[model samples]
Target: MNELSLPTSTEAAIRRVEELGEALKQNFPEYVFPVEHSLHGGMYARTIRMPAGTAAVGTLIRVPTLLIVSGHVRINSGDRVYELQGYHVLEGEINRKQMAWALEDTEITMIFATQAKTVDEAEREFTVEFEQLQNRKKEISA
Candidate 1:
């Protein structure tokens, strides 16, 4: 999908990101003002929780399309971290090592990127699978 096809939902995505930030603040009081950012093509919000030895923990929410990639992490080194197993709207769980940083006591920095191509590919696959299911159902029903 191109920009022109997604103009209306872009505003909704921004609003959702803002609302998500507010919710995180209210829910995770121990975490300081979570860093929130909206780039030209995508939006991201993250909050950091520092609990001594094992670096800081962060919860990140990102809109990479209609697919909302939300997950948590434990930042070990300066720029290295482990993405805790969790859910994204489209990919479900991307449990892997990802990069993150601590800006200060009150904020943590995270990078967000668009997954438009991935989303498109998954949609196409789902469409094909769905058609196959429909045909099977028709044969069985007949």
Candidate 2:
């Protein structure tokens, strides 16, 4: 049996995510992760649509989250690469960067834990992941 493996090192994962994000951005300039709903206090969900043949990279999340993918996608979750189609769900602790390619037009919903009082606050939380990772790197370098 052939088992698919993914990049497991932190540095390699980060680099891959950065490259994937840039490539995706160049191809899908209008791609955006908008909040889809709030799941009770300190929890929120956001969704992004990836056109077929496009890919996206995600920042390191400090907390565990749920990922629901609609349509076909190939995903690298730092430890494994999964090829999924139709409606699929992934839930785990996602403290490392990840990348995904849309085999078909895909809508991905990410549900995460946060301490935000409103959608704006939750969005801010989402944007700060990269900064947090950067700070961690700086601390390691110093």
Q: Write the per-residue lDDT of candidate 1 for residues 38-65, one digit (tens) a residue.
A: 3434333222333322222222222233
Query: Per-prediction RMSD in angstroms?
Result: 17.8, 7.8
Residue pairs of candidate 1 with colliding backbone atoms = none
Colliding residue pairs in candidate 2? none
Cα error, candidate 2, residue 28 (Å): 7.3
Clash count, one per candidate: 0, 0
Reference-based TM-score, model 2:
0.68
What's the distance in Å from true for residue 101, model 2?
0.9
Worst 10 residues of 1 by lDDT: 90-99
Among these predictions, the greatest TM-score belongs to 2
